[model samples]
Target: MKRLLNAIRDQFELTHNEAKSALLFFVIILVNLLLYYSYSAYTVNEQSEILIEDYGKTEIPESEERKSNWVDYGSSYKKSAKKVERFSFDPNVATNEQFERLGFPKYLAKTIINYRSKGGKFKYKEDLLKIYSMKPELYADIENLVSLPSKLDKKTPDFDEHRVIAEEKPAFAPKKTFTISKFDINTADTTQLMQIKGIGKVFASRIIKYRDILGGFHSIDQVGETYGLDPTVLPELKKYAVLNTKVKKIRINDLENFRHPYLRYNQVKVIVAYRKQHGNFRNTEDLKQIKILDEATISKIEPYLEF
Candidate 1:
């Protein structure tokens, strides 16, 4: 033990007294660790034995044991028929009361009504599935009961409404008018964007897609930058478009790859390499140090980069 302590003192560049103290401390810690593990193992085994003995002594009542094994298999094991009743009704024209009478929940019935109030129509039986919170089991129960065609005619935009019996068909109510005079371009969804006269589903989706890629629009002119958007639609878009949200900026020091629409692959590589060599960029002026990044390129991408 003396020889070992002397060797440790030399190896660790420590005095003999310091080495002895360290050795003593290490021995004490090792003893404590061993004792802790032994105590834990003994306590766990004792608890396990106590649990097993207690469980063996305890007895479950026969009623509860039988109930535990009972699994409800659809409507067979149920005490009564499902509260939901089946009925023939038009989802588009069905009143809230009619939906409730068919055993639909109040919230679900309200959602169906709200969907139609927003110009949503159930053209086919499958379209009912599009309604929010509509369950497959509920739809399956009423599959043959809806007063609409199972499938739409491929060639026609509108399906024939007379497919169901004349008396069974529900009278069509006038659709509620929905209009948006103005909305923030940064926050408007595809639904709101499509309300514009010239902006259809494609343009609406493209604008949103580009906006996401750009980290939200900073200017109204940015909306025009969206690919395939018609120039004629710019007038109408500018009239209603507002940009209230701040643009999401990228951290120049932390980013492994630049994902902005304005920055090219080569530019991103150069910027990352420069940051590695020179450290974090302080501002756009430091970015201008890269010869490849001209004034125009730096100016365009400057707003998106954070120091």
Candidate 2:
């Protein structure tokens, strides 16, 4: 090939050494061009075949996809942290949508938003407990979801037509003024005691402590044994205080769906309690053995219950 190139160079009127050197350069250039053409053809073929191979590889379904930072396997990484820091809500300015976003029940969200629209602000944190149709315990579960305005957002909320409807709703019963003696000392739970006109957690706890220390409260005055038990509270306390020695201890089992006061016909909580205290029931009739439960309550709940 070199000799042929040398002769061709000579025929073109080039010197032997010059023709040889020129032929060598031409050979190098030709080899480079061949390589470039090969690479270009390979690249084109690769691109065309990419679709046939599913864009170079098969895609994973979203469920099987590698998740982004916020998502993993299924849920958001931030959401997985059970103890969520609650969002702040300006009650006066909060919308029903905002309340729902905070996980308030639909009725509660509407009531809270409507309450604020009527020139109302939660003067105290506990004032939130007074919303109609809201249970004290349910309110507590959602309480952490409440977020007040920052110092910059501290302006009071204006009252609107929504407020009128909320005001009309009587969330609380007429505060039954009662002495501790009027409430069956044994029967009152924290909830029933709180319903008494003037009672709060501190006073209620004191009454229970007093009952425990004395083995049982024989009289309403014995409640005075509690530290910080205001002597003047007695005038109000006497109305609610009922001294009954026959106290029943109701144990809470699975907390998911027990102790709901509205569920007066709950056979499940009673059955669960019975099973815990006595043992697996020998028969269905044994359900009536619970003093607080009756045949009607059992009949209403029998379908959902088990041993």
Candidate 3:
């Protein structure tokens, strides 16, 4: 140690007092570091004990404790469950309480009551199957206990001897025939369309609404697309209806071009993007440039395109 100090003194020419002062300063710093480490350890241990004591003494309110108990026990508690007792029932006349006792859900019981109150009748046991909420398994369980009339009274024919004789006399006479006037489907309003034999207000309105959506019908066959129009009535409608082929044309560049029933949003996006990239479409055939547009779709939408 002394030789090392001599080498240090020779290298830097330090006085003995200066070397001793530097050594003393380093020792003081080392002691301070050790003291700080010990103090920190003691503080951490004291804080941990206080935290554990506070946690052990924490108290929940009574209401919160009760709520927690309910959350844990409510679903499994037998007293909270609905008691269903099977019994013979007539859905048409059974009271709501009776229906409930017979195992019908509360909403279903109310529905059945409302249906009866509105003059709806369960003419047969099978009619209960029409309840929107009645599951097949539940129906199967109660099917045997439901009592309903074998046949409704309205379905029974009323016998009249005098009317029967008059009908038999008229059976030999000729049947009358009527001619229906043909009308233009494009120009015919709901009132005029309802003049057709089987066309009612609902059917006429549907036909007009669909025609407006299409801009106008190009063919009488397109009338078949009207919602709720029966297939059997299509022939009758075709015989009396004529298409003028005058339809409102949609501009290809219009922002609302996607409103057309035949053009989907994606197809419209592709068409608009292509028009911007390659310039406006020159003709209907230019639509084929979009790979997703099949020949069938192009043909269907061609009549409605202006450019």
For every model shown, what is its TM-score relative to the native structure? 0.42, 0.22, 0.41
In terms of lDDT, model 2 sits at: 0.59
Candidate 1 lDDT over 1-307, as tens digits, reads: 9998867665553556778998999999999999999999999999999999878676666797789976443332122234556778999899998886776666678899999998989978999898866767767767788998876545654436545444766778899896667899989999889877667777788899998999988888878887656566688888888878888999989988867788888889999999999999988999889998899988878777778
CA deviation > 4 Å runs, candidate 3: 1-179, 254-256
Maximum-TM-score candidate: 1
lDDT of 2 by residue, 25-68 (tens): 88999999999999999999998897768766566666534444
By TM-score, rank the candidates, best first: 1, 3, 2
Better of 1 and 3 by TM-score: 1
The true-versus-predicted C-alpha distance at residue 222 of model 2, in Å, is 0.7
Best candidate per lDDT, number? Answer: 1
- For candidate 3, lDDT tens digit of each residue in 158-267? 35312554444445557667666777889998877776655677778888888898899887878878765655567777778886659888888655445677878798
Candidate closer to the true structure by TM-score (higher is better), 2 or 3: 3
Model 3 CA lDDT for position 151: 32
Model 1: residues with Cα > 4 Å off, grouped in runs: 1-179
